[model samples]
Target: MMLTRRTITRGPFFWLSVSSGIVIMAFILLPLIQLFVAPSVEMLRVSIQDKDVAHSIWLSIYTAALAALISFFFGTPLAYLLARHDFKGKRIVEGIIDLPIAIPHPVVGIAILGVAGKNHVFGQLLAELGIRVMGSVTGIVTVLTFVALPFYLDAAKAGFEAVSPRLEKVSRSLGASMFSTFFRITFPLAWRSMLVGLIMSSARAIGEFGAVVIVAYHPMIAPVLIYERFEAYGLKYSQPVAVWLVLISLILFFLLRILTLRKTVEQ
Candidate 1:
């Protein structure tokens, strides 16, 4: 009986799964591990003190955070609409939302350029308002928002879906307005998921490179700096900045995992 149980517990499929998992995990971790250790302690310290590098990192974080914030305010209602309603073009709308992920990053920048061209009518209007897209902080935020919005919307939609509609109905039955009930019932339960979405969107924004590079390279977000350094001075110069980005990314990853784990437990 013991022998039979051991074979069942450690079947070929189990062994194969573990082997494949190990291989994939190692493949992903190898580069990150190598990067983290590439720069000497002294190099990292000096890089930290570099004002330009510090500013680049801060710009990346600030722009990403702003994009996520924009998603929250503008996206919440749309997310709720998608989650609760069965419209004729709902699937199409969702697909449209996912298009940013499917589109190439470089192409995203190009498309933004076309829209923001000084010759285009909309571009002229923006120009008239003194909002320049190329080589400006506004351009960077716009690109980040474009890339990050989908992540926030998807998460928020899922969050609203998980919430029971019966609660909303109850709130309404209690003589509460739809607006009042949302704040009282739906938002409270859904806020956690929305927060998780916010973090995800922010992380996505922070990592954007190709689009932001084309739109606002002068502002030099961390990824842009990494590319600039790598192009100008090779990996030796780039790796330290990369290390800092990796650290920030790791923090976001951990925080995301914690929120996800807690949400799972609560559910």
Candidate 2:
């Protein structure tokens, strides 16, 4: 009778959803919680002070920022077009943009290697320009750009979609050029989503490891550094670096949530 009454009050679907969400949240939060507590404060302090650890973290941030900037400049026009126009094969273009997220990270590394190889025309061109994509900072940045692009593109497209096109048309009808209208109207309205996307893309780039390790193992980023430390000296050495990465990632996630909430409220 009590179970039936409760189900009648809110429905079984509601109860099931609540339970499922609790389970998923626990699964996600448990490991991070354990990791945060596992390292001694002294160990974390020592890791923070380590020059290599510091360098690796800085490298990760630097490369991710570069990748984000590249995506912003190269992707914005495409993102805007996708949001505002309809054309043949547009879905195909979107699928290609999103393909990176679906492919395996190591496979991504190998594919990059093939394109950047000395025998390939594109690779030869890069070589002629004195750009080495293997075992260099350039390789790391390239790998990050490949892996992180889709997030920025998706966020940008969604943001632009949220903006009403009637306003843009009205601006153009009032004697504004397409460029002026885009910057003053469409872009201003969509900047929040673009900014969120940029940070999210950078955050994704910061956590990349498998491809970077396969390409540029030197000048290591934080994730690759964490892996190397774990392999060489075990968790005692790796945990501290992981702690710092998690802390930084958490901050990014928090900002994403705040922006997401604001976007929702605006809608």
Candidate 3:
């Protein structure tokens, strides 16, 4: 048997690593960099001032925020359960949670429409109640929440699992109730991961287009607006709004990352 140590750091393995990293950097970073190329001060000023663009931007933020909040409210309990218990169909439940990610957006739109469109059972019932999902804000929020939930749920599950069960037991023994233990100990410790999930869910919700367009095309979100502008006016018009969306998303995403980092440090 023989062993050899390479003296050159830039050998085959090192070059391979460098090439892979460059490929990723090109794919991920280049497109993002492209967003900043156009939209001069005047163009951006005009884009922001445009009523349709403003409406779409506001709608995107509003729906994405609502979706993230909904995820936070519902996903917390699901996270706790998946972390604290084991049972038959656990994997099935997980797969279901992730189904939206794997499923085509158009299919998701069709499924939602089938159940909630004007002629469908729930849609008719809701119509009587003066609530319509088709071509409305409600539909927009519903689809965003449906598609973005897995991001929050998966992240929250991982966070809760990271929490030590022994600590929870100690809290119980010291007279803390289950709810108290979760709020006072587990939640605070898991906040970082939860924050990460919030960002991911928000991002997904804000960027959703295909599903949203099928269900509610009247009220345009950023992605839909981008598509509309591109189709109607051409790339020049669409590029400005696209640039704005990228900038806003990047800002909020980094803010979430910073908040999570701070929470981790405090913990």
Candidate 4:
């Protein structure tokens, strides 16, 4: 009798849970659907043909890819160290790495400007060397990197942690050097997570506007361009560009998802 009563109550709870999930999914997807449908097909086509829009899209992709590459090269070592070591102040170090995530993105842009603006020390030095950061592609990449670092770093750290130390130890015991063991064993096992991190970092960088706009507004990325169009013209002009950006993002995201899933199944 108790079991029968419990089963009857469980049905209601299960339906309630499913209803809540459906509501949340609709809430999240509705905006995206509107973005796609609100713009006419003709407007989307014309927006994509605009030279400035095309250039901004290309610039966003290029700079974001460069930022992700830089993060992958430098952050991976740190992630490995954080995962494997028990050093003093490790928590503090990790906190510092994650601090950017907690800070307002515009503040990050301002902070970066203070350190890397034309009159600042590093900025002055770089200017002397003829490398402009403020109002240049370099600045865009710099701001993107600053804001996107934590995502990739945390993902990589988690990936490395997921790898079994025992496998690395075995590789080392077989006369493999540490570097060889990591590349041959640890990295391979952990690469899928790292790739996911890279995709997320690149996506975040591409979508970043607050920081990038503050740093370099001339060679505009897509987000900055969308804002400029909205403020200068109106939603009629901006919506089309926004729709393009969303379509591009969604396409890339799904491609990466498919690739990641395939790799996971193979492994």
Best prediction by TM-score: 1
Poorest stretch of ten by lDDT in candidate 3? 1-10
Global lDDT for candidate 1? Answer: 0.93
lDDT tens per residue, model 4, 79-108: 999999999999999999989888898888
**Candidate 2 vs candidate 4: which has greater TM-score?**
2
Best by lDDT: 1
Give all candidate RMSDs, comma-separated: 2.8, 3.1, 4.0, 3.8
What TM value does model 3 have?
A: 0.92
C-alpha displacement of 107 in model 4, angstroms? 0.7
The clash number for model 2 is 0
Better of 3 and 4 by TM-score: 3
Question: Candidate 3 on 137-199: residue-level lDDT in tens?
Answer: 999999999999999999999999999999999999999999999899998889888989998
Measured on C-alpha atoms, candidate 2 has an lDDT of: 0.92
What are the clashing pairs of model 4?
none
Query: Each candidate's TM vs. the true structure?
Result: 0.96, 0.93, 0.92, 0.91
Instruction: State the lDDT at 108 in candidate 2.
Output: 89
Q: What is the C-alpha lDDT of each candidate?
A: 0.93, 0.92, 0.90, 0.88
lDDT of 3: 0.90
Off by over 4 Å in 2: 1-16
Q: What clash count goes with each model?
A: 0, 0, 0, 0
Task: Write out the backbone clash pairs for model 3.
Answer: none
